[model samples]
Target: MNAPEPSAPGVRPEQEALFSTTAEHYARFRPGLPGPAVQLLAGTLAGRRAPVLLDLGTGTGQVPQALLAAVPRLAHVEAVDVNRAMLVQSRSVLGPLLGGRTLRLVHGSAHSYTAASGTDSVAPDLVTCCRSFHWMDRPAVLAMADRVAAPDATVAIMGDGSLWTHRAGWTRQLRELIQRHLGTARRAGPADAYTAPVRSYEEDLAASPWSDVAEHRCPVPRTWTPQGVVGYLRTTSFANAGLFPDSRHHDVFERDALTLLTALAEEDGPLVEQAEFRVLLARRPGGAR
Candidate 1:
């Protein structure tokens, strides 16, 4: 596979330097796949015989843990991450469920890690990447997935963009208040503010070595208390806890997120929104295409 491109401008440095430092907080704050999303992913692949799984950039094992409930017959599961600290934390969270069979956690970069030298097996029956797909170089990663994945294997990627900012009117205003307080440029929409520059599912899958590709979209909803929202932001890449030598920026981000949540909290009901996620699936070619 070709070398992964340098992260787009400011994104690379912040993602690498920041997330590892705040690994624990990130693991706690990062959202897990809702039941429906997991079910949808499982439904597509359940027919496969004895599927071995590889979850790329499996920070804290959220994706894998969710998958356990949906696809219980998992023969083998391997998770790879760039940050060793994240893998360690994932081991703690994931060890119990995968007791008898050792949970495979590899410390490596997804952009370049060849499956042959890296994993005991050269190709897995299934390969998955969650939110971290945007962090790696897309072309190289897709090529790597194509190379390392088994013939007839299905590769999947899923992301829930604009997760926190899904509420329309109140969400829009709350995000505005936070940006103003943080003294950042005002964004067009709450989702726009945190959006990352990555290839669309259609574009990336079309360019890869897959024979047939399909897109599945699901609205995976989850409720967040006022406190949960604040806790969630603490684990974000934009918080830049590591980028800044001091913790002041983190404090600022937390405070602003709290202010927004507090203002929106209702008398009896919790703040909630319709969180939508997209799953892109591609099947590796069975023979020379």
Candidate 2:
């Protein structure tokens, strides 16, 4: 299937496929959800004997990799991604990790993901959308979750702020440098500028069937090397190579950004990102479990 056309509240029509071409960079350098956040997500499955997971926007299979590592007893996972390349990367990353457990990949939008069957045994005990909710039609996906999620299943919407949203002296400098190359508006894909979502994730949750909710915050301290920073940027929508007019333009930008980052790292010691993983745990009105 072709990639999902961007029409979600978090993603406008312009930011198509989001990270369609950066699968390798995403698998390698994308600082996935924090360990504490993954642990918290894992903790939600303790009530189930052999928990099954339905992870939306399972980019590069980070959430599953982290969850499976944390919970060895995870029975099965249904990972969905609109970008087939991401799913391909997911297969490689998760293949070695799954010790004979089941992993089914759905190549479509999250809202379009349905279980292979309607049996309770196949319904997911835990449903997670991490770091990718902004790229989805929130209401539609949650509605779909209501249909497929187990009666007592927990629906978690989670993510953290990125370096583009970070406010630090050096990060601001880096953002400025990126703007110089890509322009003032934060580039979404090769064609469009990004717009902040009109509604908050909490608002979307409150309006959906999964209205009963709890918010969790995990403070994560991260240190990045100059090269690590560059690799990570390669995966970002704001500064990816596609946003540049040409490969040569991108190369120059990366070169200049690295020089600035190296200098900043040396002067400031360690380049740190004080990121917080936030999750909205939503359930039915009377609660599932």
Candidate 3:
């Protein structure tokens, strides 16, 4: 049977399939949350004895992995994602750290996932969606967070823009090369094309129940080699290897992309990708600003 089509605009059905097959590449090449970002998350739960966290769309469990490494007192984490393949990769990545603490891998989307209801159940002190909120129904997810979160809980929507959107000299040249090989239009899945987001994340958050929002910007410096850029591109929706019609097509694109990146890097030491990591914190009304 075929997969169901994505109902929402700006969501491509191919995303689910692409991520499922590229989980290994994602886990290997995707960057983790910066130290300051993790520290900010930890600071929010400073007074709690044993903080519990809910990571929505927790791809390969990167957010949880970083949090567990930084915040030793965190007692439990519920890593939720619709893709089971990503959860499998997450299990492998988080294997060593699961000794004393609890790491529950729940296979579900952000909007539908419910916390355990009994008195023994812990309310999440922090709910984080990193680089995955754009794919979700923001209002619905915020409503779910309102229902499941502790009174003082924080909902952090974090992302650094993708490789396709980055604006650097080398990145611009690389994009043009991709367009020349593929086409002028952006590709999503196999035949689907990419569409720009209609609404800003801030606009969606302000309309939700958790409307007390604050923004944090962290400059994360990254140096990417030609091979590293190619690896990362494979993990993105616009440039996933699976999107190509044939192996030959994918090989051609990869060869050209690498050659272009290498030529650009020859002028400089390595390609310095432009990235400003952003975290938008939304809290319940009347909570800390």
Q: Which is the leading candidate under TM-score?
A: 2
Off by over 4 Å in 2: 1-17, 117-121
lDDT, candidate 3, at 132:
86
Top model by lDDT, which number?
2
Clashes of each: 0, 0, 0
Q: Can you write out model 1's per-residue Cα lDDT over 224-263, one digit (the tens) per residue?
A: 7877766665565543344333587657766776766776
- lDDT, residue 24, model 1: 81
Model 2, global lDDT: 0.83
C-alpha lDDT score of every prediction, in listed order: 0.66, 0.83, 0.81
- In the range 165-233, model 3's lDDT, one tens digit per residue, is 898778888888878877888876667677766899888888898888889999999999899999998
The candidate, 1 or 3, that scores higher on lDDT is: 3
List the pairs of residues colliding in candidate 3: none
In order of appearance, the predictions have TM-scores of 0.80, 0.91, 0.91
Q: What residue pairs are clashing in model 1?
A: none
